[model samples]
Every structure is written in structure tokens, then in C-alpha cells.
Target: MRLTIDHRTTYRFTAPQGRVVQLLRMTPRNTHDQTVAAWDINIDCDARLREHRDGFGNITTMLYAEGPLSGIEISVSGEVVTSSSSGVLHGTFEPLPAALFLRSTPATHAEPALAAFAQAATVGRAPIAALHALNAAVHERFTLVDGRPEAGLTVTAAFARETATARDLAQMFVAAARAAGFPARYVTGYCDALPNGRPTPHGWADAWVEGLGWVGFDPTLGRSPEAHHVRVAVALDAAGCSPVAGSRLGEGREWLDVEVQVSGQD
Candidate 1:
């Protein structure tokens, strides 16, 4: 499948600022199951973009801009060809040991309730089957929301809620997987399964199975990622692989808006 993506993010500040700096993990890399055919990032204002790879091997870009400005926009367009990998990752960069992913971040801390739930969901099952059962359990337990996830929402809080965004679900999955004695990590990227588009990028979780290496599971979709999924960045939690993370030397308040479209063809 060939997929095309258009993503734009805009920020409006209540007061003028002096400077802005951002770290972006918006670019996808080539893996055995996926190939980047073309990609570009455009800034609406004058900014300097330096490209580098992060500790997780994600393609990252640093943007620095002089600002007395009220707003700025970041636009990304790309094309990628992907093949069905049955959710098992192949030929992808892995700098750190898989055990590192077992470490929990603030957002993915598994509280007692979540840990117990994981234990109950996967009990008496094999490793691979147990992961599938856990994924299905998560999907059945929460209603999936389609919009921006609440900032700084933790897995414990999201698990208590009746509904969850993709990010929240992914974080919850990571927490549960870790609690279940499986090394897991958060993933941020694109999926072309939506009818039109989404306000933000997609998210999922990957777990390290004994014989499978790293396998992708999307609790949001209750299935393993297929050809429609474009894998980008992976980290201990969403914040680590967040598409944009930065600070602006400004005052007052700021408003943000995001738009993402992903279309695929065979």
C-alpha cells in the first residue's frame, strides 16, 4: 500500500514572544515493511531546522525561530510505501535493549488497579495469546474517542475514564503490558483507517514477545497494525515520541490546533 499524509499544526499566542524552539519527531524512517518515498516539512515563518536522530533512532528535527510573533505553523507532507508485516517489526533501528522499555514513565505508571487488571486479563495464556487477550480487553473496556487527548493525562486516570483517545489507550496498553511482565513502549505515527482525517496523529503500543521481537498492537483498533499503519517514533511514553515538544519565550496563554490526513492506496 502507498500512503500519503498531510499534517499541520498551528499555535497562537496571546502575547508576543522573543524566541521559540521545538523538537519534532514527525519524520518516519525506512524499515523492512515500510519505505519513505518522499517527505517534507514547511514552516510558515522564518525558522532554522536541523535534522538529527534521537536516542531511540527516530528522525528528529530541531526548529529555532526568532519571534515577536503571535503565531506559527508547521506543515508536513509525505508519501510512504508499506507492506503487511502482520504487526511484527522488521529491519528497524533499535539502539537500546528491549528491557529499557519495561521502565515506566509518569504517564504510563501502572497503578494497582491496572496491574491487577493486566494480571487477570492474561492469566493462563501463552505470551503471544496473552498479549492479544490484553489488547482485546482494553478495547472492550473503554470507549474510543477521536480527538486531542488531555494533556498530561496519565494511564491511571485514563483507565478510570469511560472513554479514551488513541494516545490514552496506547499509554494504558504500555502500562498494562509492562505490568504483565512484557516489555512495552509507546508509538506515535499515522494510520489511514479513519474515514476523513483526525485532529491529531495516531498512537499505539509495541510489546517485545519472546520469539516475535517487537510487535505492534493497537488497543484503539483491537488488532495488530497492518499495511495502513505508518510506524514513526517509539519511546517509553507518548511525551517521549510526541510529534512536537518545545517552549516559547512568551507570556500569557497559547492556543493550539492540529490537523492530520492520511490516505492509502494499493
Candidate 2:
């Protein structure tokens, strides 16, 4: 299957800012299982960008802006073609390794609730069924409520409390996988193809099987990502795998707006 993706992020900072720097995880990685037919990341402003691969072999871009700037906008657009390989990533520069993923991060720490869930999960069943049970349980039992950030609460704790955003959902998925003895990792990317290349809603989770290696799962969709999914970065949490992470050397408050769009390969 083939997929096309376009993701754009807009930032508005108050007053004149001195320096701005952001790390962008925009490139669709080429993995042993997924092939990159064609991919390119375009930047609107004339700033500096440096490319680097993270510990997980995810392609990352470090960007910085200089001088008093009103706002900063970064847009990424690309296309990729993928073929199924028994859920194993092959024939690509980066293959999801076991070491990089198994390790826990701030957002992926396992708690008692997740451990108990993993213990109760129908392990003998197929991965899809198990994952479906997890998703359905999460969706049905918990209420998706919006509120201020939790007071230093981890994703597992949030699940116990029944509140989260798309990011928190991803975290919970990771913790559950870890509890199940799966070397799960967190992923961030675009969802359904939005019109005019507009950025759309997204979610992530862990994918590890006894023989299938690491795959992509969306608890939001309750299934492993097929052709519709366009993967960007994978880490232990939202902060670790954030598509954009950086700091702005400015005073007062700042505003940020992010948008994304993912489309199927034509």
C-alpha cells in the first residue's frame, strides 16, 4: 500500500522574540518493513535546520530561528509507498530494534493499573483481538474529558482516573504493552488524509508481538495501522517522540497552533 502525508505547524509568539529553536520529527522513516517511495520536508521560513537520527533511528530535524520574529511556521509534506511484510519492518534504513523500544521513559512508565490490565488481558488470543479488547475497554470504561494537565500524574494513573487526550491515550497504550511483556514504544504521526493537505487529528501506541517484531497500533482506531497510517517518530512518550520540541528566547506569553493532514497513496 502507498500513503501520502502533509503536516503543518504554526506558532505565534507575543512581541519581538530573539531566538527560536525547534526540533522537527517530520520525515516518514524508511523501515525494513516500510519503503519510502518519495519524501521531502519543506520549510517556509529561511532558518537553519540540522538533521539527526535519534537512538531509535528515527529521522529528526533540529531547527532554529534568529532575531525578533513575530511568529514561526513550519510545514512538512511528503509521500511514501509501503508493502506488508508479516508485520515485520524490513528493507529500510531503520528497523524498530528491541533495545531502543523496551526501555521506559517519563511518559511510558508502567503503573499498577496497567500491570493489572496486562495480567488480565487475553494473552492466548490473537494480537488484534487483545488490542481490540484493550481499546474497547479503554473507550467504554473511561470518559474522554478535557481539563487542565494532571498534577504530575503518569499516563497509567490517568487511565485509572479516566481522562486523557490523544497523547495520553498513546502513553497508556505503551504502558499496557510494557506490562504485557511487549517491548512497546510511543509513536506520533498524522491520521486520515485531510483535504488541501491540512493537518488532521492523530494518535499512537505500542506494537510488539512474539514473532512480528514492533508494529504500529492506534487504540483510537482499535487496529494496527495499515496503508492509511503515516509514521513519523517513535519514542517512550509524547515528549520524547514529539514532532516539534524546542525553546523560544522571548519574554511574556506565546501561542502555538498545530495542524496535520494524511492521505492515502493515489
lDDT of each: 0.92, 0.67
* TM-score of each candidate structure, all chains considered together: 0.97, 0.83
Q: Candidate 1: which pairs clash?
A: none
**Candidate 1 at 156: error in angstroms?**
0.8
Best by TM-score: 1
Clashes of 2: 11
What is the TM-score of candidate 1?
0.97
Per-residue lDDT tens digits for candidate 1, residues 59-146, read 9999999989788899999999999878999998999999999999998999999999999999999999999999999988998877
Model 2 off-target regions past 4 Å?
A: 85-88, 92-100, 123-132, 143-153, 193-201
